[model samples]
Each structure stands twice: as structure tokens, then as C-alpha cells.
Target: MRLEELISQFQKKDKKAFGKLYEMYAVNICGVINTIVRNEARAEEICHDVFIKVWDNADRYDPSKGRFFTWILNIARNAAIDELRSKSHKREKLNLSTDFFVGILERPEEDDKRDFDSTRLKKMLGKLKKKCIELIEMLYFRGYTQQDASEVLQIPVGTVKTRNRNCISQLRKNMSAS
Candidate 1:
């Protein structure tokens, strides 16, 4: 069956269609989630949740706005990003306490290297314009959505998107030249 027909049936809550769609897209979707969340097991779990979300909200999709896969991809991306921003994930990542004999479980040299990398990152951002720094801090460091950044920056969403792309490009150039 063609993708459109499958999607239509999915929107109508057809189980077979949903199953076929999952078979078709699950691997790719899980891979993307893993890339963002960096945990294979968690990515699979989040992928399952994203599919459930997709199934539940199937009727909300508008083909005229974008492709069905893109809609699902956006949902997966947002879910992965949300997982990254979650407090539980933060706590999981913050398990850097000293071991009984190891002093810091993470080596002191690695810690110093991380501090140096942070200082270098700060220097790079300092070289960028104030607007670029603010945009990077919001979209990357603080995990603001593009729409949220747009509202906060008082710019259109498209403008925020454009600025983010341009700013990242400039940042890449700065890093490469150094």
C-alpha cells in the first residue's frame, strides 16, 4: 500500500496500518532518538512513547503543512529533547561524585580538560555578537524551543531560525580557524 493510504488508515485508527507504519519507521526513529538522548535503551523506550503519541494524535496531522514522516520526526525530536531537559536525565548525568578511593570517579585531568573546554567555549561565544550569544545560550544551553526564543527575543520564529543557522555557521568558522 502507498504511504498516503497507510497514513489515512492510521488517522482512522487502523491497527494494521499503525503496525505497518511502526515496522517501516521504528528503526530510523529510534536511531534519531538515540542520537539526541545518547542512550540506546532510553531511546527505544522514548521511541515507543513517541509512537504512542503519534497514534493518539494521528488525526491532528495536516498533510498540507508537511509530510507525515516529518510530523512524526518532529514529535520524536521534541520527545528526545524533552528527555534531555528532564530532571531525571540531569540527575543521571550528574553522578560524578568521588569514589571511596578514586577521589573523583572522573579523573582530575578530565575535569581540568572540561573546564578548559568550557573556557574556550565561553571565549568563542564572546567573539560572536551579543545576539548570537543570546540565541545560542537559549536554544542550546537553556533548551528553549524556537517559538519560545522567538517570543522572548521579540523576533519572528523564522527570524530566530535563520539567526540560529547563521550563528552556528559563524561559530563553526570560528572553531575551525582556531
Candidate 2:
């Protein structure tokens, strides 16, 4: 069944539908959170909270508003952004630089973790150019707009879209190969 069908059933309190939705989106949701939070455990916690928010706000969803994935992405991003703005995060920021998601790839312990399967992710990323990775990390993972990424990366604005599209295509190919 389609995601919209499942969502409709879920709105009626169908457990099976809800379970299917969870299973389908859990990894994606976690990945989105991890991109923002940069901590696996905290990302997992936020992932759960995001789903709960989605469930509780089911009635508020409007098909005309946007794609379901886009909606959930907004919720997950907002939650992760909120966490970053919290008091505890403020304390942690005093000691560490506010690096983006690509920095996580360089963490030795995180790279070795089986739960995150960082090795596989690294291999997939290996297929992409360094510039592609940077562009993707800035635009998608760190939530930078095209204008923002262009300014930060010192590239043309049009380059941001083309570069991001190419990067995502490379990622899709890598995923298919894996």
C-alpha cells in the first residue's frame, strides 16, 4: 500500500499501519536526526520523539500542504534544531566547535561502530568527490540554503543545485550498488 493509505489508516488508530510506517521511516528519520544532532544516542531519542509528535499531530496533516516525507522532515529537523538550542547543548558547544555532519565521518570511534555501520557509509561516500560531499553536507545535512551554501563554499548559486543533484545521484547509485 501507499504511504498515504497507511497514514490514513494510522489516523484511524490502526496499529498495523502505524507499525508499517515506523518500520519504513525509522532509518530515514534516525539519519535525519543524526545529521543535525551528531550523536547517535541523542539522535535515536529524538527519532522516537519525532514519530510521537507525528502520531499525535496526525489530524493536522494536510495532503495539500506537502509530501508526507517533507512534513516529517520538517518535524525531525525542528526537533533536532531545538535540541541543539537547548541549555545542555549550549554547555557542550563551549568545549567543541560547531561542526557539521561530515565531521562525524571523521570520528574514529564512530567510524568503528557496528551499530551505525559507518564503514559501509564511508565506502558509499568514497564514490563521491570531496566537493560533492562538502556540498551535500552543507546543503542537505546542515540545512543551509543554496544562497548560504554558495556564500560559505564561495561557489556560484547555480553550482549548488547542480552539485547537490550530482551528489545525491552518486549517493543513490552507491546505495543501489550496496
Candidate 3:
């Protein structure tokens, strides 16, 4: 049977159609969840939960918005994010959206518990000027693409690469001087 036929049957709550869809896409969905959650068991659980949610919200899905697989991909990604957020809420109370960079830069207290290399990393980071440090931090530490850094810093994207090269050169010069 065609994918559209399977999806049509699934939306109508046909158990066999859902089963066939699960057999076809379970691994892919789990893989997507695993990339975000970094745990196989958790990924599998999320995969199952996501399908349940998909079934529950079947009426809301519109083919005009996206393909069936794309819709499922979004659902899987969102479920993985929710799982991570729930786990984070249980462990500690911190707003990751706002504090991601600040948390990386500061310890906040002596007793604060985190497995991050802040002290030695801070010293190494001290070698660069503020802009160079920010750029390097965004690119390497925070995983910002050149285009992202450019937009955030209000500089041309082309300048990001040039400045990054110069920043590394400065870092090398500072290291040799020390």
C-alpha cells in the first residue's frame, strides 16, 4: 500500500495501518529522538510516546502544511525536547533558553555542581580580547554557525571568517608570548 493510503487509514484509527506505519518508521523516529536525547532506551520510549501523541492528534495533521514524514519528524523532535526539559526540571531549576551562555561562563557559587571545565577554560579564554573571545566562544563552545554569529553581532557573514582567522592568529600570538 502507498504511504498516503497508510496515513489515510491511520487518521481513521485503523490499527493495521498504524502497525504498518510503525514498522516502517519506528527506527527512523527512534534515531531522530536518540540524536537529541543521547540515550537509546529513552529514545525508544519517546518514539512510542510520540506515536501515541500522533494518533491522539491525528485530526490536526494537514497534508497541505507538510509531508507525513515531516510531520512525524517534527513530532519526534518536539517529544525529545519535552523529555529533555522534563528531565532538566527534575535535576535542577535553571532556564536553559536564557542561561545557556551564562551558565557556561560562571559557576554562580562554590558548591554549585556541574561537570564543566570552567577554571582552566577561563584562563585560556582570558588570552583573547572581548569580541574575539565572544566570536570564538559562539563558534566553538556554543556551536553557532558563522551566519548566526554575524547576525547576532551585526557584522557581515564574510567578516565572521576573516575575524575568526585573525582571532585564532591573535590567540596563537598570545600563547607564544606567554
Candidate 4:
């Protein structure tokens, strides 16, 4: 069957149609998810969740918005980003035993007393908002795809590119100023 016909059957909750769709797209979707999450096992779990999400929200898929592939590709990215956020939050909670602000502020000083470059990077990054820093970290330092960063930041992909361009511009300006 054609993709639209399969999707139509899927929307009507046809099990075999859904299976066929899964068979066709599951690998690609998992690959997209894996690009963000980086763990094959976790990517597999999140990929399964994305399909579940697709099944649950089948009625919401409007072809005028885009193709079925794009729709599910989006769903997969969203699930992967959510998984990243959840993992980050869990790590934060697990590491929350700092001695309030005093230790939080002093531990770095004690640990990196000789690292002037680290200090300079912190000073330079101080001008950027926490959001922009997170964006940079997610996109560059953490090896996220542009699509993954866009979904994680809840911004359009075009906006992510523009903001990244502007951020890089400012970073160069700051580095040159020092």
C-alpha cells in the first residue's frame, strides 16, 4: 500500500498497517533519535516511545503540515530531547549535595586554581544568557544535530542557525577583545 493509504489505516487503528509503517520507518527514526541521545540502548527505548507517541496522536497528523516522514521525524527528535532533559535533571538532582552557594562558588576556585583559560572562558561566557550557553553546549560541545538542538530549545531550526551564527560572531568578538 502507498504511505497515505497506510497512514489512513493507521489513523483508524489498524494494527497491521501500523506494523508496516513501523517496519518502514523505525530504523530511520531510531537513527535520528540516536544522534541526540548517543546511547544505543536508550535510543532504542526512546524510539519505541516515539512510535507509541505517534500511535497515540495519529489523528493529529495533518498532511498539509508536512509529509508523514517529517511528522514522525519530529516526534522522534522531541522524544530524544525529552530523554536528554530528563537525564540532565536526574543528574542535577543526584549531584545537589553542594554546601549551598559557598561550596558551589569555592570548589571551582580550589580545583582550577592554575587554569587561567578556564577562568577567561567563564568571564567571556558571562555575557551570554544561560539559555544561549545551553544552546551552544547542546549543539557544539555535546554533539547534538541542528534538528535535535532546535527541538530541545523549542526554537525553529532557522532560528537556531541564526542564533548560533550570532553567538559565534559574539564569541569571536570577545576573544579578540582580550
How close is every model to the real structure, measured as TM-score? Answer: 0.52, 0.79, 0.52, 0.52
Task: List the candidate 4 regions with Cα displacement exceeding 4 Å.
Answer: 89-178
Considering summed lDDT, which 10 consecutive residues are worst modelled in model 1?
96-105
Indicate whether candidate 1 or candidate 2 has the larger lDDT.
2
The reply for model 3, stretches above 4 Å from the true place, is 89-178
Compute the lDDT of residue 164 as modeled in candidate 4. 90
lDDT comparing candidate 2 with the true structure: 0.78
Task: Let me know the TM-score candidate 4 reaches against the reference structure.
Answer: 0.52
Clashes of each: 0, 0, 0, 0
For residue 55, model 1's alpha carbon misses the true position, in angstroms, by 0.5
Candidates in order have lDDT scores of 0.74, 0.78, 0.73, 0.73
lDDT of 2 by residue, 17-125 (tens): 9889889888998887887777898999999999999889888888888887777888887888888888476755432223543554667774466555667777788
Question: Evaluated with lDDT, which candidate comes out highest?
Answer: 2
RMSD of each: 10.0, 3.4, 11.8, 12.4
Compute the lDDT of residue 164 as modeled in candidate 2. 88
In candidate 3 the C-alpha lDDT for residue 27 amounts to 82
Which residue segments of model 2 deviate by more than 4 Å? 89-101, 104-115
Please write out the lDDT profile of model 1 over residues 12-120, one tens digit for every residue.
Answer: 9999999999999898788667656667889899999999999999899998999887788889878887877674657565321112112222245457564234445
Ranking by lDDT: 2, 1, 3, 4
Residue-level lDDT of model 4, residues 102-166, one tens digit each, is 22233566565652235665656656655566666566434467898888779999999899988
**Best prediction by TM-score:** 2
